[model samples]
Target: MNRCLSGLVGILFVSISLVSCQTDEEIKRQRYITEGILIFKNNCANCHQDKGQGVASLYPPIAGSDYLRDKKSVICLIRYGQQGKIVVNGKVYNRPMPAQPQLSDLEVAELITYMYNEWGGETKLTNVKDVTPILNACKK
Candidate 1:
């Protein structure tokens, strides 16, 4: 009976330890994705829709978009807004996407992380450390 109890305890401890072993980077990535969802709902949902399917002939879809091929341009446009006509998946959208200058570099990083993970076929975080320099350079 004693040996059985000890073995059970050891197994439980190992299980708990394994469950708690998630890397810090993964934790931060999850947090960024959570915040990004809220940001999108508040700032982008009206035109882009909740699932990023876009509004007919006006806004462009973000999910499965060919436009996402230009990561740099996507990042720049998020902060500086977009003008003129743009094509997405062979459809032309002429509406202006107002700039979200209020979003901090961190917020942009979080947003991109969420977007890429959810739709851009990415499985990694887009760290704020990487986003700041890009944002700084795009400031006009």
Candidate 2:
């Protein structure tokens, strides 16, 4: 009975340790994704729609957009805003995209991660370390 109890305790301890053993990157990724969902819903959903399907010819569709190939441009558009005409998957969208000045660098990172994961077929996190400098360099 003693040996059985000890074995069970050891198993439980191992399970607890394993569950708590997430790396920093993993934790950051989870946090970014969580915040990103909210940001998208609040700021982006009206134009882009909840599923990233934009309105007919007025807004550009985010899901399956060929423009997503230009990660830097997408990042810039999100931060600094977009104007003039742009083409997505052969569709032309001339409406201006308002900048999200309320989003910080970290929030931008989270937003990018969420966008890429949801629409761009990416699984890795877009760390804020990568987003800050890009935002700083925005010409728009």
Highest TM-score: give the candidate number. Answer: 1
Location of the lowest summed lDDT over 10 successive residues in candidate 2 = 131-140
Candidate 2 regions with alpha-carbon error over 4 angstroms: 1-18
Which digits, one per residue and each the tens of the lDDT, describe model 1 over residues 26-129?
A: 98999999999999899888889999998888889999999988887889999999999998999988978999999999999999999999999998899999
lDDT per prediction?
0.92, 0.91
In terms of lDDT, model 1 sits at: 0.92
Cα lDDT of model 2 by residue, 5-119, tens digit: 9999999999999979988888888889999999999999999999999999999999999999999888888987899999999988899899888888898899999999889
Candidate 1 regions with alpha-carbon error over 4 angstroms: 1-12
* Model 1 TM-score, all chains together: 0.90
